[model samples]
Target: MTSPFASKLRTNYCPSDEEVAEIKALLVEPCLRLKGLDDKITALQKALDKLTQERDSLEAYVQAHTALISPSRRLPLDIIQEIFVACLPTHRNCVMDAREAPVLLGRLCSSWRAVSLSTPRLWASLHVVDVGRLAPVHDSSSRRLEERAALIPEVTRTWLGRSGQCPLSVSLYTFPFPSDPVAPTILETLIQVAPRWQHIQFTIPAAFLDTQFQLAAKDVPILKSIALHQYDPFQVPNLAWDRLEVLRGSNVTGVAISGCDLVLPRLPLRWTELTALSTLGSRDSPVSGERHISSQEAMELISKCPQLRTLSVLFEEHGLFAETEAHPIVHPLLQTFHCRGNVSTFTFLPGCLSLPELKEFTFLVHLPGSDAYMDDENGRPLVRFLAASSHLESLHIGISQFSSSFLQEILRSFPPTLQRLRINAMSKIMWGARLGSSLDDAILSVITPGLGDAAPCPCPALKELQIDRCTAISDSALLQFISARAATLKRIQVDFAREVELDIRPSLQPFIETGLDICITHVRPTRKVSAWEGLPHAERPLLD
Candidate 1:
């Protein structure tokens, strides 16, 4: 609407008292109209707020009733129990952790708790760690220790009680202390349920085996597997050895079980009935006093274990070939054999025994001296053994001080049926000399198949290849090997001791796109120089 003061409205003009009165009169009409519109907006906002509140209340009511018929709540009791069982860890026995199942399942709701409690399999296996004297004890702490000691037995009893008639797999460890009062109580409780034990492992001390530990042959009728740690072989509980299928000998924790700590011949195990055996305790850090069986003893153990399918043992370096050179023991059912020792262990492979049905083989030569593995002579026995095992699928060799020719001969002996090959050329050093690695480009070229259709290759069906500390293997040879076997190769892992100067990813990208798994790692280059970089005035040095 046009007004007389329209020109003055936007200008910086101060109005007189008479002009101001007239402007106020004109503004009164619009101000009353604006007040009326404000009243209408306030009423509409109140109605909208009420409608939103009602909608939210109705939606919440529907959701509340819908949850009553939720899929988990409506699931059958058996199905719910199965779901709970699936939540349990498959790798290890169940621990008393509320953060995990079956304890976690019990914390969800009353129905889930009931289902978890009623399921026998959920409670069939348990791993209990008794903190014993390791728990600090002083005044009030001493009382807490006694309370915890008393509570563990009761908790274990209740946990096992839920297992109805199901077989039990139990692992009990007592923190390397025998004087703890709680360990004996737990041991007593476990012995009471020995009939249902299918697998049992103990990492307790010798004192626990004295008067507290008692198990008759009749008590462990269903026990199939047993692992004894820290106890002397002589003091080990005399179980039903004939029925046992698996035996594992662990390291000496407290004291040497016997004079040599696990002399293979002295153990009271019925070797013929066993299917799997492992005596090398903690391969990364082998415990002191753990004895390695002689070559003769290893052969003797193999002959005794007719039904053995897997054997992992450490052998000594010295043995006479005249003992078993003529007649090699032939096993029909043995499949996997893992041996660790010095040069003699590899030598024993050919002279000792034959595994016709062998599928997997691992030989680890540790701490080879200057004279050991210097030539291909010791590796010839390994080639003979590999030739005899027609069904071998996996081969793992870890050694140091190996010559290139020795490793080449070993690689050539790999059977066509082999699918997994792992070679670890450990850093070689003897006395004051640093030895060179045998795993070089030449060795990789041997396995890399030719482009010719008729040309043969080692491990043609190889799916996995792992080479560690092969600082001599170059990027070109590694790529050639992978490209030649890309059709069957699924995983390739190569670790170099020296830093990789070239990036091999561009060449490997095509295979990676086709779902090939490749892992290539190398150490970082260090700013290191030779000890005697400068000579005596650029001539001969004073030091020898």
Candidate 2:
């Protein structure tokens, strides 16, 4: 049975004629055996292919039926609706996107769609934007766009109709296009349901505010809160001012109606009934001198409104000439006060106010120039105000700079109930000047417990600490501060002003594992340039 070519099996040697003839004679029986084996394998292969197709069909059939008996299919409608409701965006109104919740829930299946559509609360809130803003600019079909815009009225009407008489929460934004009648038509449709407007935000132009809102006053019977973004002189929509509890506006001062100048608070809103009022200026341009109140006017509102608990006002220097020293006015019911804007105007604010029940106070001072007008040392008036407010539980200070003595005195004045403290400062480079800021290791050491003998902790009940833009605090000081306060501190958030080379996570891992929330971020340092280097290069042409 041995073949002569066995020696050359693994070699490249060629066989001679006698050896080739011997190899061919030896392969005849094996060739016949190989052909018979191939036929047997072909039959088995066909059987395997048929069995695989049948198994795949059975698996698909079983999988299709298994979904019918899933546990999710037995979920109660109320429970399913609650789960669907939880998927909504809490911070903002729902948008018209299939990729997100309310809309996405409808596309799940027939049962889910029926539940979502039947739930009136799901369609009660909506954020509407003009189709022109969302349509692709590359699309050259104006007729199609016009038709799309024309459908807004119908779509809005249908959406609102699904609410089933529920109070509506809506935010509408429209760009200025007088030729397009869609915004006006949308406004009209919204006006028809004015009675159901529980909360709304409007960012329309001046013309719509003047024309449509004039007739909307009587219709908005249950409207309790409204925010306006219009800046032009327009009459107050004769809403039920007595019933309105909350009012908010941005850059909405110096409004004149029929040629009479009146500030926002000076408007004939039932000042006594308003529980909350915010006239925040736009942050895009902080010093625009648009929407702010003087210290005197703030005092007037505080003294006039007995039920007012929360007031946020931006202060500027334009209204400083009229105010002089006066006796402290006591507000018994005010709990939260947020005052920001120019620091110069904040000088007289603390001198004339006494908020005995104030629990939370935020003073974010924006330094417009190199100096604060408070000639008195260490913010004495402010310290006195904080000292008198024994119920203060939270205090937030954001200034361009802080003197060490002032910060220490304010901290010393904090009550034992103060549970939260946030200190933020802008870098000196932001103002293009070098100024003295006291947020350093020394100040942090002051707050760190057990560091000094017999030095009482400022806020013993403190549970949260947030510090930002204080570049002078080192890693060791921050770590020690967190370690000392680890028992009481539940949350710690710090944004280092410069790059941190050390990873402090290993040192604080034990505290984090024990349920302490921690977040640390670093700001990348950029190359510093001098005034001369920032000047235009000699090669570029100058502008006219």
Candidate 3:
């Protein structure tokens, strides 16, 4: 039997060799199919890349169309120019370093730059700062100053030339004192075209007087306003400024009365002219010498200005007094008088109070630390003079001396035509107290006579009340007053009060129910309660 089995194995009787080949072929068929699948995958990836490119192209086209269809893109060129000019800053700056303005307009499109360039008013105002920063070459600090000085005039001329005959308002500020001397040349050019100049401001150092005077003498009759900063007052030369209406002085460290005197004769009394004068300095500053304008000089100059309506006289170390026996009267047409100084007592000499047309008056009296005029009989005459103004509608009185009697006299004497009343920094007074108990009581007594027949009722015609930094008003008394007079009250504003416990809600509830306006502002005294949230709706601001 073993011999028979060996013979069969040698003969390969189970299956033929061709059957094995067939099995191998079947396994290889699956490998071939996998290779075909990989080829198809590569093709699909290529198709995906093509689709992605097409999608990106479509998105870019849509963005372009959207931008073109925007309303801003459709605005007329003139309107667009107006928008650009509106973006210019009104605040005066010595230098403007930002380049985004013209550049941005230029980059928008060719048409925009054309429109912007054509609008002369768009370029008439020029402000330059740190001209040295625009230099192409690095130089020593001193050299940079020289280069900046030389470049200033050229830059100004270029801007003005582009502006054509349009009026120019130029502000030039530079530092380190340039040796280049271009500013004078530019100013000379401006003087030649003086009629085209409307406004000019200079913040240059005091060393540039010669250049300034030369330009000022050019008789810029069209110049309406001129402002000088950090310059000698005397260096300002006289000109035929028939159209000049406004003159301002800033950072004036040096006083040259000689120049002012020379220019005074040229200033005529034109009814249309209005002047705003201001000076600032400490009592000990050297600038005080130049700041003095004698009463005689002031009167003489003002007499020529018959049409003058508004006058603001501010003095630091001095006061207006009877300097000359002439005692020239102020313009009869004057309507507003605002004066501030250390003078504790000022008497509007017999005819000084002749401004019958005066409407608004503000007087700030600062008492000397050891002065006696605040308490003496000397202030009586001044008080009487102020009380006699019949046309005064708005009166603001600030006193350094806290005297109930003095304040009471003023309130009792004030003109009945008054409409607006503001009291600040007053002492506290008890409600229903005696007249002499506190200054506040005196004030209330003076005003009570003008109110309704009731004790605390406000003036019938009074519409607005503003109280600040005053601790004298009692909550109950104020509430009683408002509740009785809420029909006439329109608006009330309070800030920074000392009495935090005063709850005005009960008194203001009537106004809120009737839809009248009321506003009250105060700080939280402690973290115990939310004062703002707790306030009544009428006293709280409406939020969106």
Candidate 4:
């Protein structure tokens, strides 16, 4: 059949008007009919969409009912508890955040919240930052956040309450002094839980802690480890402190005190029971005319601490110990001793103590402008000390400024059994004479060409090596250092190797592939600021 909308045939040379009209005729009615069908199709699509939505709703309802009868609800509580324990904070996330671990577990069903809350260990670790230092505002317009002081205590209460009777590893820091109201409130709240505190770090003023020691003494049957700051060494109370026992017939086992007056005789610490003692001098602030500890007093403490495993002392000035040859206090179990101080202090330390088991020793001598490598008062004593500690496996020298001959002399005298060595050439406090610290050639010369005994490598059993801020060393020297010990080199970390002209990624790839963990951070050409340290909770890292 002929289509009606097709153009009509014209017969005449110039077609009549009627013929032209027929040719130009419109299909309006047919088009209108198709539009009606399109409208109908649109209505049907809306209906289909409505039906799909209803079907989806019904499917969701069916799944909900199915879930109610699911076998997962019958999972044993012990298994759920194990899963909850696994969800607790890990090392990478040392502080618990709201989206992680116990907090995340609590956000689930009621049963899960109950399991998380009941796990005492989950709540035992409380890491808090000082609230007072979070926002410092000195204007008269906005008063210091005195109102938020109550918030700290409330949170502390909730954590301690949830912890039940579990022993706590709490780092409680309140910055500044007793002036901050939040400091006192938080301290008061923590003291209420004194019996449960197993390991604690309190960096507040000594006044805040004075009463707590007595409170802790009464109820704390085993206060094993403590780190205190802003201590007044001479403030040791005259009362029969001996009666205040921290452990079961033992004093606190491990202790670290910083920024305190130096008076060993009046220390609240019990020297006899300590396994680790860290008496670090304060570099942050030094008030002249304040009482200081003599080398004689330091030796006395070491002599008394028979069970001490680790001892760290940083003396600011020369030690004027009265005796040149004090009776050598033999430390049978001493493993690590880190000493950082002026030349005279280190010169006197070795003669006072005999450590048979000393394994790691670090000596960082601050060289004054007047000092020389062979300073009559300083250099020879350290040599004598090195002779005494020939058994040491690890030795670190922060004082890199030395005459090469002087360093070679010391290296030659190193114990044959020495393994791990570090030369930190970038300590900020070390002044002058680091010109001879291009240590690669000197160090490599000591090692023979073969592995272990075949070569006379200073450290045969050396498993790990760390080189930081050694810009003078070439890539060849550093690589050769590792290659010499490839058989025993399990790990190597090169920090701030700026001057070296090798791409670490491609150059060290083979060593990495063979099970070496290599970390290289190229030196930044700018200075970096120190991280915040005022509060126990670093920068208010509280769980939100």
Choose the strongest candidate by lDDT: 1
Model 3: how far residue 239 lies from native, Å: 16
Please give, for residues 145-241, the per-residue lDDT of candidate 3 as tens digits. 6665567667666667777787767755443333343545555655555667566655444445333544332355556555444333345443333
Clashing pairs in 2: none
Count backbone clashes in candidate 4. Answer: 4
Per-residue accuracy of model 2 over 1-544 as CA lDDT, tens digit each: 5765677898989888998888898999999999999999999999999999999999999999999899999999899989988998998888766898788999989988999999988888887776544444455686676676777788888889888898888877664332454667888888788778877776655456656765334566666666655433234333332232223222112111211122564355556676666666333222212356677778887887787788777776653463456798888888988888665555668878888899999998764564653323736777788778889888888745555566666667777888888988543444566554647777777678876332687788899988877687888888999999999999989988788867788999999999999998888756554445546664534332
Stretch of 10 with least lDDT, candidate 4? 282-291
Question: Is 2 or 4 the stronger prediction by lDDT?
Answer: 2
Best by TM-score: 2
lDDT of 4 by residue, 309-401 (tens): 998776555444444566767878889998766556666766777887888998776545435333334466666767677578888876454
- For model 1 the local lDDT of residue 163 reads 95
Q: Give candidate 1's error at residue 499 in angstroms.
A: 4.5
TM-score between candidate 1 and the true structure: 0.72
Q: Best to worst by lDDT, what's the order?
A: 1, 2, 4, 3
lDDT of 3 at 150: 61
User: Once superposed on the true structure, which residue ranges of model 3 sit more than 4 Å away at CA?
Assistant: 1-74, 82-114, 126-162, 170-195, 201-206, 216-218, 229-290, 294-297, 315-330, 349-351, 366-397, 411-544
Q: TM-scores of the models, in the given order?
A: 0.72, 0.73, 0.52, 0.69
Cα RMSDs of all predictions? 11.4, 9.4, 17.4, 11.3
How many clashes in candidate 3? Answer: 5
Instruction: Give the Cα-based TM-score of candidate 2 against the true structure.
Output: 0.73
